[model samples]
Target: MPVTQAPITPTYADSPPGPPVLELTGISKRFNGIHALNDVGLTIRAGEVMALIGENGAGKSTMVKTLTGIYQPDAGSILLDGKPVVLKSPQEAMQAGITAVHQETVMFDELSVAENIYVGRQPTRAGGRIDWRRIEQEAEALFARLEVALPVRARVKDLSVAQRHFVEIARALSQEARVVIMDEPTAALSQREIRELYRIIAQLKAAGTAVIFISHKFDEIFEVADRYTVLRDGRFVADGALSAITEAELVALMVGRAVNDAYPKAQAEIGGPLLEVDKLCHSTEFDQVSFTLRRGEILGFYGLVGAGRSEVMQAIFGMTPGVTGNVRLEGKPVAISTPSQAIAHGIAYVPEDRQHHGAHLTMPIQQNISLPILSKIGFFLRGHRAHETQIARHFAEQLELKASHLTQHVSELSGGNQQKVVLGKWLATDPKVIILDEPTKGIDIGSKAAVHRFISELVTRGLSVILVSSELPEVLGLADRVVVMQHGHVRRVFERGEATPEIVVAAASGIELESARQEENAA
Candidate 1:
């Protein structure tokens, strides 16, 4: 049995009871003779932030799709404001006061912020012309209400990822949404941005809007959510006040097993440098960066958002042009100008933006796993079916991939499962060095353990790893050495023995040692 974890609990004072803003009962959905959801139930009152907690394949996405009307339930009842409503399409759901701000914000990138917010349902004048003035004013008001400053006239493509999420939220509010669903909204956001999102969620709750927040991060759930709804294996496991459950208890509910250790870095022999980068430069991104990855070692790169960490990795992997660097593999100089060349040189990179750059979501799981080695296996692929299956299944099982079958589309699996497929795909290439960027960004606690263990095992097998992450604990736990960066500059490098959370964060933020010590004293 697992025990309670460190203090990370949310407490909500009881309020006057009222009818639920939204109610779901006996919901069930099936696909290809497999149940995606079975007799699921949920109830959320107005002004409450209810966390939809689950493992990757625990029917959370299915519930979200069903609620958003992207998929109709085979059997269920949905009651909005105590009245039953049938949602046949997303528009119907939106018009019925239920809207969602997905992780990947979809909008007209070339259009203005205000325009994208009111793209489909712009207010019209008597002559049927778009009331542009009203749209801009309303958008400004929405940002003001959320306490964010964004230019209404700015193009959507020019906005940052966090800003794009705000635009989607503003669009939902413009529709006068009664129930707002935020699905992994902060997966890509910085710590500061995540705090801002929490404030916005509080604002919505105060305005009597029922919010359904879905995330794999436990700390976020306990900090922002008032209640909890856990799903496991396509069925509802438990629902209750977050204040009443411990993190260990919640983990048990979510995965039906104890996650004793969130970060279990297995011991591996540390060898001499396996890959060395000297004076790597990517103008306007990262300048004069150098690092060494020893065989059976994990080098962690930690920095804030836009700190040029990923950019440097892209340059190292040949995904970026104009990168001047001296790269040596096992003491042999090599020049990699493209991803193909990098792969051919026994290097693999799993990007941070998995949905777009990491995996081909449209392809089946097996096909995706076999993608990096298609040339090696021959393009004809007529008699290579068994060979592909053997390679794909080997890595999939190593990663603990969850799917009904290997033929299932990558898009159909949950976000964490999709990440696993991507990881498996790259590992199948049998690379000598792997770069995992934000490997566990949106993964569940249980799955995070699996990935960490896999990374450890990789090192034991004599493969080097470069891990780039925004999460401090993950870096401190898994890394042999920590490199901090700020404003495209390498700030400091700390060995595992000397790297502390405060010191590393201070370095990343460009804070001096004395100042950090003073701040700690102030605290």
Candidate 2:
């Protein structure tokens, strides 16, 4: 089993418990004769953060939808302040004081921040005309309350990911939400942004709001939640105060077994440099970036959001325009101007945004898996079905991808499974080098471990990898060498033995190495 850390005492552990603002009793949901949730029960009291933990496909999404009135439970009772109530729709749920800030931060990109915050319930004047002035003022006041600064008049599309999330929270609070559910809120946030979110949650709790914090991150659960509830195989496995349980216990509850290690970074024979970038520069994104990846090695790129790590990766993958760089593969210069050219040059990139860029949601698993190699399988489409199925099944089984069948649509699968399909699709290209950006960003610990093991296996088989991740532990655990970047500049490079959490964090955050060393010495 992975070494267990000391149990952390939650911040609100000793607070006097209040009556539950929302309670779910004997909840059961089914779809097409498949039980997604079975007799599950949960209670969220005011002024507390209750962590909802589960593995992917453990019915956490179903429960969230049911609670938010997107899915009506076949059998259950929802109690609002101990009174039975039925939430027939999302509007009804909002009217009943329930609101959610989803992981994707659903909002209209073209709408201004103030407009998005008050879209459905825009402030009105005497004649029912939109009071745009009131909207902006109220939004500004709301952001001020959260201690966050955001331009209310700016369009949502121009805002950063973290800024958009602040708008989502502001919108939730504007709805007078007494029960605020945050579903995987930190999946895409940087460490600093996550800290700010925690601060905001604390503020919400102090204001008597009940928050349901759902995430696969154990550290977040222990740090912020007063209580935790675990679901396994669509059934409630455990529920208790956060201070009373340990991380090891929580993992066992979620997966029904021990995970020996989250990162199984295998040692592989390091060969000659497989891919090299000399003075790679992207206009307005990143500049003067340089790195080298070797055969059977995992090269990690670490940076905070806006640090231009992803931008650099995209440029290398031929997705960014105006990229000026010299790329060498096996000591030979290669010009990759498009994704097809990159693929032909034996390079594949599994993008971070899997939903929008990685997979074809409407296509079948087999089709998505075979998409990269369709041209090779006869363009006339004669006798291609069996060939496609064989290819899909091969990579699917190789990656331990779980799906109803190869014909199943990618959209029907869970987040973890969809990620697997993305990985499978790329592996089908038989590329010498692969770039995985935030490979396990939103998946559960079990799935993250699986992906890590798979990546290690790929390196062992002589495939070079460039892993871009925001999670420090992941970078430290899997990378043979780490490239730290800050503000579009290469900050530092550390070998495996030399890199530590402190060192990487300092480099990524622009802390001078000598100053960090001096601080360490003073300590």
Residues 1-523 of candidate 2 have per-residue lDDT tens digits of: 2322344443444544767799999999977456889999998888989999875567888999998889998998999999999989998998999988888888999999999999998989999899999999999999999999888999999987888889988988998898999998886788999999999999999999999999755668888999988887689877778888765556546545322357787879999889999999977888899888988999999876568888888888888889997999999999988999999999999999999999999999999998898888864687899888899999888888888889999999988889999999999999999999999877766777789889888998879999998766677788999998887999888888767565565576554445347655775
- Model 2 pairs whose backbones collide: none
TM-score per candidate, in order?
0.58, 0.59
Tens digit of per-residue lDDT, candidate 1, span 1-523: 2322333344445532798999999999987556889999999989999999875567888999999999999998999988999999999999998988888888899999999998888898889999999999999999998889999999999998899999988988888999999998986788999898899999999999999999766778889988998887689877888878766566546534332356677799998988999988887788888888999999999876557999988888898988887999999999999999999999999998889999999999989999999888876867687888888888889899989989899999977788999999998888999999999876666677788888878888888999998766678788899989876888888888666664665576554555346645775
For all candidates, the clash counts are: 0, 0
- lDDT of candidate 2 vs native? 0.85
Task: List candidate 2 segments past 4 Å from native.
Answer: 1-260, 381-383, 512-523
In candidate 1 the C-alpha lDDT for residue 508 amounts to 68
Q: Give lDDT for model 1.
A: 0.84
User: What's model 1's lDDT at 158?
Assistant: 99
Stretches of model 1 off by over 4 angstroms after superposition: 1-16, 140-144, 147-151, 190-192, 258-523
